[model samples]
Target: MNTFTETTNTASTWGLYEQMRPQEIEAIQEKTPIAYLPWGAIEYHGNHNPTGLDSIKAFNLCKDLAEKNGGLVFPVVNLAANLIKSYPGVNFPKHSIEFSENLIRLVCEEYLEQLVAQGFKIVVLLSGHAGEPHLTILKTVAEEFNNKYPDKRFWALAEFDILPNDLLVANHSAIGETSLQLFYAPETVDLETLPKDRLITLELDAVSGDDPRLATIALGEQIVTSFVKNGSIIIEELKQKYL
Candidate 1:
């Protein structure tokens, strides 16, 4: 038996076993101890999106996933792996890829160790910020952790990976991520304040995508639906094959 729970009341659900009453915790412990970690970064998206976009995306997506798969959901990790970009006056030059990667690895290892100590064996590191270097570093660290532990597992996904490779393109605050955030946290988005021109790949280069002004709650719902549907398939496959 593992210590975990399946609940949709996000505001009331216990994020960690430590946060729950002893009885509740024991009940979950008798069930499943697996957990879902939402890894996100605090970085600039653009003039429109929130700096906590990555965290927000991860949190919401994890919530959806946790509801479907019974497990504890750790709070969003706001500071993820990223680099600093010095824009004259628009944004601060806060690149911290190396630093962030080290910190992310340390924090994740510490957290996973703590959970293991508490009798949990599974911890998933789902990264919402899809920076190539960030993802690379994250995967490397996660693999090393798994190799060292051997009895535990770490995993990640940004939802886009489920799509066919040729059908996808490198998009930052464009159709992919923006659509996800829009679908997950529409209230946080304010299209009325958006630039007349679309901002493309806010991370690497100054590129724009389709006018985000046209982004609607409906589109957001569709994205979430797709993610949940595909994520369910993936989870089931992994569980049957690995767990």
Candidate 2:
């Protein structure tokens, strides 16, 4: 169903990181030596969109990027995001279930270190959730890694960070993300779940930004194209700069 995702990195049994064998990883690394880590949360999206939208969107986008640019997509980081720090004590689920900023930093730091240990020359952290606090943490950790590992390259960003300003319409449970899924994984989106002829809002439907009803696969494709293009450039740059 996901035509774009189904392609690329699927060459002769070599697949994403999860399905790759030792020899496959070494072979791919010999060619690209790049690793991609996609992250998002299991938090609510809305009545129509699945809750895994964030992570799924990121993962699918990563697959597209790897297909175009050549790399291995690490497994999705589903438990990475946390509640907005501004709402300190107010959490949808128990605080224990949601890791804190410190824990998040540790996880990212460890992941980066392990990727490097696995012989990856370049590492990318891609997020779909775009939660302010989580993004901030990821960016900080990336900078630290870049400084500490002069021999390797590290980059961290949400899907929109590299996009041209005009295409930066990313948001939660809205047109931007929904359209992305429509293009990347249409089977996961259920627009009919929302009431007929009713306005969608953040409070009532967990929808934000312009109405998700406006999302289209064409628009999603445009966004995906931009992401892959810009991301490829970044990887090339890292190779030149660090490798």
Candidate 3:
């Protein structure tokens, strides 16, 4: 009876490891040996969305999935690789808080090692940060960890990778990401702050793709629903294979 509708209730306190009591965690562990680790970054997402948008989105999605499918939801890692060197309108001193690729890889490896040591057989790493370098590093770390720990399973993926191609169209603070923020973290987005006169360019702003002005909460909800449904299926499959 774990339907999509049942899982979309964001108010549910079933998935978050930080929110659950020790006994409750023990009970969940008895049922499933899978864990969800959400990784995000504190990078600029234009004027409308918060810097923590990536992490927030990933954390919420992981929570939704863990609620439907049995698993432990680890706290989101907010620091990620932000490859915004060439992008304009970037306030490096103020907003850009990033870790090196090697450091990130090491962190991921350690996290996996600890999770496996804690008795989790399968660890699903969902990165909210869409930077190619970040994703590549994560994938490499996951591969190396799996090689070292043959008994444990590690799966790393970016958030967009799980979505359909149509919904997959996203960019820095564009319609896709804006809509998602509107749906998941409404308070963090400020559409009013966006310039209304001229079209935002990569130099003027880090925004790309379709205008975010066209974004709507309805569209965001649809995307989230689809992502959760698809993600739940993937998690179930992983469980069957590894746990």
lDDT of 1 by residue, 144-231 (tens): 7678777666666665666544333345555556666676666666656665554434343322455555666565566666666677
Model 3 clashing residue pairs (backbone): none
> Over the stretch 75-112, how does candidate 2's per-residue lDDT look in tens digits?
99876555432234432332212467787888998999
Per-residue lDDT over 1-243 for candidate 3, one digit per residue giving the tens place of the 0 to 100 score: 012354343432355788888899877787777789999888877778898888888888777777777688999998687556534465434576877878898888888888987888888898888786788889888988889888777889877787877886647788888888898878788898888999976656677777888898878888878888887788778777776
Candidate lDDT scores, in order, read 0.61, 0.77, 0.78
Q: In every candidate, how many clashes are there?
A: 15, 0, 0
In model 3, how large is the Cα lDDT of residue 128? 84
Candidate 1 steric clashes: 15
Off by over 4 Å in 2: 5-14, 84-97, 196-198
The CA lDDT at 148 in model 3 is 87
Q: Estimate each model's TM-score.
A: 0.76, 0.88, 0.89
- Output the number of the lDDT-best candidate: 3
> Each prediction's Cα RMSD?
5.8, 3.3, 3.6
Candidate 3 wrong stretches, greater than 4 Å: 1-13, 85-93
Best by TM-score: 3
